[model samples]
Target: MIVIFQYLSIILLIFLPMPHYLRESYLASSMLYSLVCSNSMKSLIQYYYDQ
Candidate 1:
């Protein structure tokens, strides 16, 4: 699911038109979002396994 979202976002980034600074910011935010999502998912999986 996360992979799919990343792919879609990348495609959007390529196709959408915006200022260069805005594009950079969007890329940064998406990277951060994915990092947070991955960390939370890892913790959730570990929690279930530890139960």
Candidate 2:
């Protein structure tokens, strides 16, 4: 799943002619999104495991 996101970002970086600052913002936002997603997923899994 993480590999898919990595490949998507790499493809976007290569094909999209975004400016340097835009690229940085995109990367930062994506990283934050992935972090939140993973954290929530972990908590959900833990909840189920505890049940």
Candidate 3:
């Protein structure tokens, strides 16, 4: 899912015009944040299981 969003944002950033609708910009930002959050959550889960 993260990979998908990364690809999507890349495509959107490339092909789409600037000054897009507010929601579109927000989606891009949220995708970036979700990627970071997901990584942290994955590590935390791994640590929990390691215990």
- The TM-score leader among the candidates is 1
Q: Number of clashing pairs, model 3?
A: 0
TM-score for every candidate vs. truth? 0.85, 0.79, 0.48
Q: After superposition, how far is residue 25 of candidate 1 from its true place, in Å?
A: 0.6
Q: Write the per-residue lDDT of candidate 1 for residues 1-51, one digit (tens) a residue.
A: 879989998999999998999999999999999999989999999999999
Cα lDDT tens digits for candidate 2, 1-51: 886977789798989999999999888888888889889999999999999
TM match of model 2 to true structure: 0.79
* Candidate No. with top lDDT: 1
Which residue pairs clash in candidate 1? Answer: none
Candidate 3: give the clashing pairs: none
Return the clash pairs for model 2, or none: none
lDDT per residue (tens digit) for residues 1-51 in model 3? 867877797787767766668657767787779888889999999999999
Write down the worst ten-residue block by lDDT for model 3. Answer: 17-26
Q: Of the candidates numbered 1 and 3, which has the greater lDDT value? A: 1
